[model samples]
Target: MELESYRYIAIDGPIGAGKTSLAKRLASLWDAQVVLEQPEENPFLADFYRNAGQHAFQTQVFFLLQRIRQLQAPLDPALLEGRFVADFMLEKDMLFAGLTLAGEELALYETLYLQLRPQARLPDLVIHLQAAPEILQARIAERGVAIEEGISLDYLQRLSECYSQFFYHYEGAPVLTVNTEHLDPAHNDADLRTLLQHIEEMRGKRAFLNQGG
Candidate 1:
């Protein structure tokens, strides 16, 4: 895929959108280091998912700090010169914070986010994977992550909308949006090849790969 030209590539999407899978595949193909969001390390995630009203603030804050620490170095060329593939963009941290926080909590989160945003480096390219919320829900159910068990189809729908809006206006870097309801790159060789071609074909500020049903 001629990935050497780009130092860092970000694979982004809502939960169950196959971002982590694709990011790992791309990194492996290029023999590059991969940085992934460590949701499993978030001590408040399960409780927050089960009872968002009670734990949302802590959950969001924990993720914000984690993202900063994980991304600060590799994202900057002077600190880390090696190529890397990241499953989540540092800015997307605000997307989740917006969804789970509001009023005073959201205001505070935004304050912290803005203060730290500059330290995070922009990726050379961003691959945005999207799918129908129903498809996303089914995938989540199949994966059976106990904490995510509490994630409703309604939430997935809302989250999908949020992602769409975010990417629609996002111009920080080149974005290649892919409809993944029918694409599985991690396990299917042909699908991965098709996706790689899409990446190579990407042009302009925005591009799309929609495998119609």
Candidate 2:
């Protein structure tokens, strides 16, 4: 497929799902600009991951605000000159919000999000990555982030559910849902190429890239 045909590609997934690796590869192949969500920028992330109930609102709000700031910025030279690949989807913002915030906190966040909705370039295509909760947990352990060390399977399960629910109705753009339980796009070139082929052939509102299919 002609890379120029896809000016903006957004890759989204839960933690340890490998969105960043694929985004980097795609950006290099297309010579496109890359936008990565800086999860480390959330000062409350460590604490929130350890004790979500106590720090959930702060962590969620911090990420929401930071992502909005990044999204609102003008197209950089690389994007203006060529295509762009991003590791996060702005639409996923609400997934985290719903998972992390409570009644009053969520209401406040919704109001703020409405006011600061970004008006920048939108994705021509989105790749929503998925994996089994067990696989996600194992990957998290291998990476060994101190803050994430305490993350339980229960939490990951809930997070995966939230992501699934959010994307179930996502109609903002063309979506390609990839089940990565057995396929590792990061180290598997064949899997990546297969997905690229699917992206090129996609014409529907949603597409699924699964192992059996």
Candidate 3:
């Protein structure tokens, strides 16, 4: 299948994995609508990063509701009339919930999630970006987002593990797992072309793409 064949595409990974950058590049290449997660818009994000135990629930809930609103509209003929690309997956909200919430908080979160989850639209294809935690941390530091400065290596490791576990059992969409530790598609034309070719050639329910490293 080619980039044009997929109606909805999602690029997902742990923080600092460059999913958003790649998503934007792919959207430009495919002339698709872009849907991005606005972490800066979340009032509790900085606080949550600084003190997860105290602010986890609020931050998670905010993101959950925001994503629900962002993706509620299905990919139908009435929308943009072309493929759409997003930086995050709707169901991954539960992965973060599992990592952050516990006891009564988790119970309440699960209830709310179950109620709102049905309205989400699944993607036609998912591109799962993977990188080592140290590499992710380096990239995070390079980007220098102030709130994200509170993100620890341990937290990134755990999140990367969570993403791996989630996608291992995922069957909702065709998945393309790309090892991006040594790939810089955003800056390298060759890397971008290679990834685009991989997307164009994908024909299985699951595929893997790794280049340069």
Candidate 4:
């Protein structure tokens, strides 16, 4: 696929899947502007992790509102001039909202979400990062966020399954699902280069690049 045709390339995945780092690298390589999600901005994340049932709705709302606000800004001229690499896609927030929010909360969330849906810029390609739960757990541990210490493997597995189900039917843009279990884009130049090749050559609705496979 010609890189010229793509104005935005988004890297998406669950936590610890290296979306941020890879987004940075891809942006640097392609001279694309980077739009990264700021998780720290969500004050409810730590509490949500400790007691999901109690703080889930607040956490989800914070993220939803924050994302909408961020996207509400005019599209950066740099991003419009060149390709853009983003660590998060607005639609992916629904994956977490669906998993964590309950009946009344979810209904409220959906209403607000629909209202803000048009604010997001649709990407030309999305890189859906994937990894085994064990890999995800280890990476999260390595990050050493005190809040994530309470996150359970079962929760990560459920999140992974939810992502799989979402991308399975996603047809909005070309998607490249990569198994990033053993591939470290941070330290492995080979892995990064391989992904770059895919980003440069891919044109299909969906593709997979599993270095582990």
Model 3, 41-107: lDDT tens digits are 9999999989999999999999999988877664444664687989999889999999999999999
The clash number for model 2 is 0
**On residues 78-105, what C-alpha lDDT tens digit does candidate 4 reach at each position?**
3366677788888987889899987889
Model 3 poorest ten-residue lDDT run: 72-81
What's the lDDT for all of these models?
0.87, 0.82, 0.88, 0.83
Candidate 3's displacement at residue 112, Å, is: 0.6
Which stretches of candidate 1 lie above 4 Å from their native place?
1-3
Candidate 3 lDDT score at position 115: 89
Put down candidate 2 lDDT per residue, 112-162, tens digits, no spaces: 777777666677788899998999999999998787887889988998898
Every model's TM-score: 0.95, 0.92, 0.95, 0.93
| Deviation of model 2 at 28, angstroms | 1.0
Backbone clash count for every predicted candidate, in the order shown: 0, 0, 0, 1
Q: How many clashing residue pairs are found in candidate 1? A: 0
Candidate order, lDDT descending? 3, 1, 4, 2
Provide the RMSD of all predictions against the true structure, rounded to 1 decimal.
Answer: 1.5, 2.1, 1.5, 1.9
lDDT of 3 at 112: 95
The local lDDT score (0 to 100) that residue 59 gets in candidate 1 is: 93
Worst 10 residues of 1 by lDDT: 1-10
The C-alpha local distance difference test score for the whole of candidate 1 amounts to: 0.87
